[model samples]
Structure formats: structure tokens, C-alpha cells
Target: MDTDLSLHASAPSPPTSPPGPKGLPVLGSLLDMGSDILGFFPKCAERYGDVVAFRLGSWPAVLLNHPDDVEHVFVDAHEDFIKNRFFWRQVTAIFGKGLLTNEGEDWLRHRRIAAPAFATRRVNDYADTMVQLTSEMLDTWTPGEVRNAHADMMSLTLRIAAKTLFDASVEADVAAMDNALNDITREITARFSRPFVIPDRVPLPGHVRYNRALRRIETIVTRIIAERQRHPGDRGDLLSALMRAHYDDGRPLSDKQLRDEAVTMLLAGHETTALALSWTVHLLSQHPSVDERLSAEVHRIIGKRRPVFEDLAELTYTGQIIIEAMRLYPPAWLIGREAVKDCEIGGYHLPSGTTIFVSPWIMHRDPRFFDDPLSFRPGRWTPEFTRQLPRFAYMPFGGGPRICIGKAFALMEASLILAAMVQRFRFQWGGDRPIKPSASITLRPKGGVPVRLHERENS
Candidate 1:
């Protein structure tokens, strides 16, 4: 293959650099990036320049560290660079071709149908649902005691997603579903990073566990879909909306498509929001001033009442806290793409079939963009400050034509849950250890975040 590393076929060029990381002769840099890959790009940034190129089994890989270069990949030349099939292939084992996995026309088609269901009004309608479910979760939370905040948030948000999206609460079976989702996400993550794993049905330890968990998830999702189909539009939740939705050609989604979408929403809708909220609370716990301000905002806005959609605009600080949390720990940390044709970005030649990674985790915290990048300062996200930041510098939910369909829904849910939690409890760190980042699909605390919750008294 004549690699077309050129802006113009005849243009002169700088000398090509050697490929990054001399690993196993055939495997190249995959092992290096995969092992201790949690903050792989940051370490790479410290070593390489803003735009670093490497290889994974002869497949070219580029990691863009600067905001402008990140834009050049996701927004500026989006059409030319689609979601890498390999990244989606891992999800393909379970989700088939849901919105998150598909590319080109199929992605566009699914988005067209699912997008309206996540409209401002539709998502706003979900605020009451979020408040109602969160209130129920809070009823169990006796304050002034220590508990695993991550587990609590995950449980609460998963229930909210089930109720709001499916009109079906997991009830006693929620734990089983949670465990299954966690297993599946971890398995898929391992698969993505190590692509040479044997067939999942081969009964290796990892494959055995992963396959069993996937079957459980499929069974649970299918039952929910079948039950919802029987009762149909009476539910008035996301399942009903998707059940009623039609493509431009008047085609409703198939059972497989429906199942994929419902499960995707179940995982995507709740997991990321819970992770974001968990980190938000953890950050606030260490910064009493931020937590105090947030508590005051919630108290003044709702005053012992449940939150309403109308309260969102007035909940400005709540929104900032969520944005800042996402900046620090974006649930979907890395977005990957593959080039279909020769392209030139930032004066560098990108040949066809190159794999590219744009990491929100790195970009949002890049020292070039954020002052004191590691600090937990919600005030930094003031309206004016946000306006001054680069457009693609902080895409917690991602950007371009493939932006998160549930962006509106996730934000509303996060803010509502945060307000609902703040209205009652103040989180205090239960452990002296610093929170560490871990990932399977969503960014999560390495171990669950434990916090002592204290109920606010006297308003």
C-alpha cells in the first residue's frame, strides 16, 4: 500500500518520524498504550508533541492532544473520519448496531428517530420522574452516617433510568442487572484494548464470565421489551416513545433494534450520569465552599420542595458543578475515529485507514486550556468563562453530528438528582485516600466512593 501522507501528491514534506514505542515486533504499541492505559494519553503528551502518531499492528494510530487538533478530527473533518469499526465492534457483540456503535447512514437514521425523543421538552418532562425516584432513594439515606456514595448513586440513577425510560423499575432484580452491566462493560473494555482475545464462547475465564453476564442482560432486556410492547403507549416513558417512534419511511424499530436501544439507554442514560454525579459529590466533599454554595442554591431554589423543570435555569450553580465534574472525569473519556481517505490536519499528513483518539479527559484538563487544571472549582465554569473556552475543549458527552443523543436528558437528570440529594444530605469524605479514575465504559472511581452523609437541618 502506497501510504498517501500528503496534502498534495506533489508537495514536499518533512522527514517521517519512526513509529512510537518498540513493543513486540508484530503488536507494536498496543500493549504499551493498553497496559496502565488509564491515563495513557497524558503520559504520551508529556513525551510526544500535541499530535502523536503510533501503530497498533500496522494500523496507524494518532492521538490528538490540542484543542484545535481535536476539533480538526471531530468537527472540522467529521465526515471524513467516522467512528472506528473496531471500537464499535466490541459493542457490536452485544448492542449490534445501536446508535453508539453504528456509523454513516445507519447512525444518521437512528439519530433522526431517537433525537426527538430526547428533545428539551421530552427531557424536561423527565425531571419530575428523576426527582420522584431520587426522593425515594433519599428516603433510605439516613444522614450523618458513612456509606458508599458511588454505589448509592449508581443504584439510585439506575432505578431512575429504568422508571423514566422504561416505566419499569428493576425492584429486587436491579442488583442483578447492575452486576450484569458492570461485567459486560468491563469485558468489552478488555476486549477493545486487547483485540486478540479468543472467541467469547471458548470458555476461557474472561470469556465465560462475560458471555454469562451478557446472556443475563439480554434476558432482562427482552422481558422488559416484551412486557412494554404488551401494554404499549399507556406507560408514556422512553420505552413507549421508542415503541411509538418511526423512521422517515414509517418503519418502527425491530425487536432486536428496540432491545439494543433500550439496553443502550439503560447503560448510557444512567451509568454516565451516576458516574458524573458521584465525582461531583466527591469533588464537593473536598471543597466545602463549593458544596456550601451548592447547598444554599438548592435550598433557596426549592425550599424543601421537589425540583421542577422550570427550576433548571435558576439552578445555574448546579449546572456548573455538573459541567466541572464532567470536565474532570468525563464519563465517556475517549472518542475514537478512523480515516476513510487521505487527510491533512494541523499541517500533518494523515493517510487513509488511520486510527485516531480524541480524549475529553485529557483535552478538558489540558494545562494549555485550564488554569490549575486539577482543581475542583465550579466557579471556573461561569457563563463568561465557559464562553471564553474553546468549543471542543470540554465535550463530556462528545460533539459533532454524533453528539450524545441523551445530552439534554443526562444534564436534566444530573442536575435534578444533585439538587434532590443536596436538598437533604451533605456528603463528607469517609476515606482519606484520593479518588482514583477507573474505566470500563464510563469513568468510575477505582473503588466505590465512600462518604458520610449528613442531613441538613434548620433550612
Candidate 2:
């Protein structure tokens, strides 16, 4: 499908000018946009101008492709928008009224309840646990080994989350939690495309998978809560902290609410961070100069010693590399919103109940703001470069009050793991196959990232 919405089109009428992509009568350019999720954005920008309009299921969406436009949507007019139900309702089906899916008063209440535990000092406190778990993961790996970086990251992050969230030390129980988290993620991904398909009542695929995942999640979360109730101790993990939290009206979280929150943190906490770490390693493997620069920085920061909480500030370049990797391949690729009332944006009208989509995968790489947008360049994240960039053009953890509660946790975990990995090891690509972004709730490497991890000769 092709759209020619130019001002001068075969001299048709005396027209004032505005830029927009002309969509096909029905399907629009969605089919031409390709099947791969992240692959379509750059192409869309090339064909259309910055604010490109398109459609999905008869709902018109304006893709904000410039930094200024991104700023307008997220920061300037934030209150007018909220998380689109179409995208999050599937997640809410399992996680319930956890922080990620709710908005308005309920969201604010939950965020306040969850805030104390995610405070900066508390996140720093969890660094020790993150490092310990990361070291444990590395100890299992032999030097000069070929391994799936993705798999290693998943297991490592799950362990960190397990220890950090519940303070649980049982290996078998942790393994079970990891397995349950995986099943929940898979189910969430499947439900996105099969939105209308009724969940099975009995042992059907969706029903069976959903029930099994929910049961596993509930069993673990309930057991932890019960133990805390039976013999409360302030272990400094999130669960223990929440255990002591009370809402504004002297109300505390209900048992179901606690379970929902545990499910939310366990699933949201580890999954995206794992993907980001895996991608950072993969990008490092492909870009040797970058790898060399990062290795030098890591070695200079902590010679023959593991990273501590204080190391995060001095490891500026390492943080830049992670930021750049997320910019190139943000784990949470697409964010959506729905309008609750009639609204006008960029001189066009959007109706009440309209579904809106905002894709970071599209905006982060917009050429108007970024030079050589598709290329991986951590240097772009220097303090000076950061000051010059528009605010909402780079939101890996989202924006506004609804921004990820676990952003600090994810960053701390990533910085520590990346710094630790680079201090002792260098990774090289295992093959020539291109790693594509596969968006399924989170942006994942379509297949898997295979890399060779060789211990640094002189570290």
C-alpha cells in the first residue's frame, strides 16, 4: 500500500501544506511495514515525515519520530495519555492490579506502597546480593568457553531477583521460581496475538499454561508471605520491606495484593534486565573497539576486584554502553496509551476511546535527533551529549509518574553484571547470523545470541 499525501500532488487543487503519510483504505501500510516489530520504524520514517500517521484495526495512530515530538507526547502532554488497555489488559489478566497495569488513584497508592523498598539507598544495599549472585553464575562457567549469553543472563538475573525480592536461599525453590517466571512470560507473549481467544476452561493450551503459571506464582508468593507473618524479620529484601509498609489510611496490603505485587516484581524485575545484559554483551562482541574501550574502563575502575555500589558512579562509560545498547535495542520496545476524551494533537482530532501507540523502538532511532541512528555508539551518552538530547526521545524505563518502579534496580543489576563480565572476560561473536529483535511483551533476540567468552589474559 502506498500513500502520496504531499502538498503538490499532480497539481491537485491550491493547497496549504502539512506533512503526513497517506494510508491505504483499509489495512494501511501495516503489511508493508514488515512482520518484524522493530524493523519497520526506520523504514516508516524514511517514507513518512516525523509525525507519521498509520492505523491498526481501524484505530489511527500517529508515530512520533522526532525528539521534539517525543518530548511533547510523553512530558509536555503526559496527563492526557495513559497506558493503553489493549496492550496491558493481557498482562493484567495474570498479574492483577499490580503497579505496571494500573493508573489513577490505584496506581498512585500502589506506587507509594512500593516506593520505600525501591529507594536509592535500598537499591544500593541490594548491590551486594547482585554481585554475589553474578559471581556465583560466573563460577559455574569455565574460561575460554562458548556459551549462550542469553541463557546465562536469564539464570543469573533470576537468582538475583529471587534473593533480592524474597531473601530466599533455597536453590531448588529458586529454580522453581525461575521456571514459573519463564512460563508466565511465554503465556503473556502468546496472549498478545490471541487476545480474543477464550482461555481454556479445562486442560486446553492457554488454560493449562495460565493455570499452571498462576499456581506456581501463588504458591511461592503465599509461602513467603505466610513465613513473614509467622516470624517477621527485616531481611532488607523487598518482600520484608513491603511486609512492614502501611497505606495512608492505616491500611496494609491484602493477601491477594501482596501476591500480585510479588508476581509483578519477580516477573518484571528480572526479565528485562536479563535481556538488556544479553544484548549489551552481544553488541560488545560485534564492536571490538567498543569492547576494548569498555574493558579498559572496567579494569581501570576495579583492578582485580569486583564492583561495589560506589563503583557505579566512576563506571560512567560502562553505564553509557548499557544506555546505548538499550537505545539500539530497548527490551520494552513498544508503549501504548488510550485517550479517554476527545483530543487534538498536531492539528488533527483524535476521538474519545481511541487507542494510541508510542513506540520507543521508533523514536529512539529517529534521524532528526540521532546521528547514524542505527549504529551502536556509546560515546553519544557522554554528559554533554545527554544535556543536548530531548527528554522523552530516550525512555528505556518509560516516563511520567508511571515510569518503572524497578528502574534503579535494573540499572544497578546491569552495571554490576556488565562491569563484572567485562573485568574478567571478553566476548566474540560465535557466528555470522544476524540477531533480530523479536517483540513478545519484551524485545528478545529472535532466536538466541551465541558468543565465545574468553577470559582476559592479564585481568
Candidate 3:
């Protein structure tokens, strides 16, 4: 998105407008973006350097690709940047005023309440459930049958999310919840990147489907919330944590607030991790040597035992594998924010209301930071290399004060699931289907990661 620093408070000298592609007429870069979002931004960054200017219809915006700039926006001046007002307005229908969309006091309160539930010790409690649920899912897969890894991962993660977050067994609700979520995400993503923001109330076919999906999800969420409230004790679930928490004034989270946070966790907890696992499986299938190394690593660490919480620390290569896959196909691909006040990002002055985009999609592949940026090399993450790498250069969970609170939990979940699955099966690329990355709300495999399952040789 282009910026005119003239509107903001004056600097001692005139701000130099950053160089960018001369977009076509009034439509700007919308047409190019429609064709390939992942390619478009990276091309701009490659051509124009780190900070690139463009337009999403009429809204002025800029893409910041430097790690230092990323640090400035998300860390140094986080208060001056909040969730993009334009984009968040579209998702509030589904996300509500939960931590995903809320700001200031409400966000702080919700974060405070939800924080304890995801504490390292507490998150460790869910490992048994994650492994058990994954094992149960694997029970149904037949050797030599080709299954969509993404679809299976979605189902497995949703079940894990339901059980771990709300302490409710949702074996029956998985299919319905997944279908509903697909519809909702399709419609919201269509709206989010459109030439202009379309109001949700409009009577488009997708809008109808989106609303129906929302209602289906609400019914399921409402059921979970009601069930939790009835058995409202310390169940070691997120809902219990929120219920046990009180506001500064001693009031508890309302049912509405609880529902909002529950849905947020439900979507985030499952979807992103599922994508990460799905992509990891895809990577493993394509890179047989990497797959062999990971298989050996998991076998060496876990070796015929169902994984336990204590085993996580030993899964070093397994952790690196997940991190590398995310670097390539980050589920949360782009981070969008709006400047609430005039701020200098990467030495350029951006005015209030300017849409600022930080895409991990572009950053992860920048040659300046990652060597042979597109290669899938897990070994690049040596402790010395990680320490020497720029802090914001490798932020899959984002950075600074408002970073994803679920970082530890998500990484642990992914490592556990990957280690368990890799140890038991060898995935062969199902040749019939092409798996392409879909940069929707979360980056997902467009056609699903199709792989022929081959159960391993030893126990």
C-alpha cells in the first residue's frame, strides 16, 4: 500500500517516498495479487528492495521485508500499531472481541485470563492427549491407501483442540466443525483480500454459506461452553482457566466473552498446527533423505514407546524439521497491522491509517537472511546459527509483546505429532494430486497433501 507522509506530522525534511512498481491504473496491484499473492509480494521485495509500496484498491499500504523493520513494527513501536482496523472489522463476526481481534484493556484482560492455561507445565499436560488422539486416527488408516494428509491432520487437530481446550470429547463434532470452518474461512479470506471490503450482510452465495457455517460452529461452541459452565471446576482446560480468572474489578468473563475466546483457541489451536504437520508430512514425503534422518531421530529418541512429556526435550531434529517447514509454509503467512499514530518503520515515515504488512512468506525466503532460501534444510538451525540469526528473521509465531501466546504450545504439539507419525509411517507422494500452498487466512495445502501411507517395518 502506498503512503503519503505529507499528511502526518512534519519531519524536519521531506520524507522520500519509497520506490515501488508502477501499478496498472486505479486497480493498482490488485490484479497481480489476485493471480499470485505469494509470488507478487516477493517479486516486489526482490525488485524494489526491503520496503515496497503498493495499493490494495484505494487503501495506502507498504510491505516491510527487513527483520529490523519487522522489529520496529511489532516490537519497538507495537503500541503505535494494532490489528489492521479494516481487516479485523471483517473477521470480528467470527472472532468477536476475543484476543485475536481485541485491543487495549479487553485484550490485556483476555490475555491475562488465558495465559495461565497455556503455561509450559500446563501445556505439557496435553501431550498425552495429543499422542493418544493421533494414535486413534492412525488406527483407521490402511497401509498402501492414499489419504489426504491435510484432511486427516485437520480432523486430528480439531479433536485435539476440542479435547485439550474445552476438556470436551468432540469425536462426533469433528466433521461438522471442519466443514463449517472451511466455509467460514473461504468467505472471510475472499473478503479480506478483495479489491474492496465487502460487508458480511450482503446476500452473496458465499455470504449465505459463511453465515450458515458460523451458525453451525456457534451451535457446537455454545454446546461446549454450556457443558463447561455446568461442570465449571478446575478441569485444566482453557475454559476452566478463564472461568477461574477474575477481572481487576473481580468480575468473571461473561459467557459471550468465554465463547469468543473459546472459538479463537478452537480455530487457532487446531488449524495452524494441522497445517504445520500437514506441510511437514509433505516435506518428508518429497525429501526422502530428510525423512530418513527424522525417522531415525524419532526412533532413536522415542523407540517403541508412546511419547511422554519428558521426551519432548530430546526431539531436537524433530523440532528443527517442524521449524523449517513453517519457514517454508508458515500457516500464518502475513501479519497485517495499521499505524494508530505516525511511526517511522525502516527509516520511512508512515502515516496513521496506513496499512502495514509484514509477510513471513516473503521474509522466510529472503536471500539476505536464509542461504539458498527455498531449500528445505533443517540442519541450518544449529544453536550457533540460531543465536547469530536476527531475532525477527525467523519469527513464525511473530515477535515482541503481542507475539502468539501459543508459541510453546504449538511447537510442542507439532513436534509430538510429527515424531509420533513419522516413527510409525513412511509417506510417499501420492503422484495423482498436486499439493499447492493456499495463502488463505492460514497457509494451507490447496488440494490437500495426498500421500500413500506405508506403515513402517519394526514395531
TM-scores for all candidates: the values are 0.93, 0.88, 0.95
lDDT of 2 by residue, 213-232 (tens): 77876787677678878988
The per-residue C-alpha lDDT of model 3 at residue 37 equals 82
Which lDDT value does model 3 have at 418? Answer: 86
Best of the two (1, 2) by lDDT: 1
Measured by lDDT, the strongest candidate is 3
Question: CA RMSD for every model?
Answer: 4.4, 5.8, 4.9
- Which regions of candidate 2 fall more than 4 Å away from where they truly are? 1-34, 40-42, 58-60, 173-187, 194-204
After superposing candidate 3 on the true structure, give the runs of residues whose Cα lies further than 4 Å from its correct spot.
Answer: 1-12, 24-26
Best by TM-score: 3
TM-score-superior candidate, 1 or 3: 3
Instruction: Quantify all predictions' global Cα lDDT against the true fold.
Output: 0.81, 0.77, 0.86
Q: Report how far residue 401 has shifted in candidate 3, in Å.
A: 1.1
Give the candidates in order of TM-score, highest first: 3, 1, 2
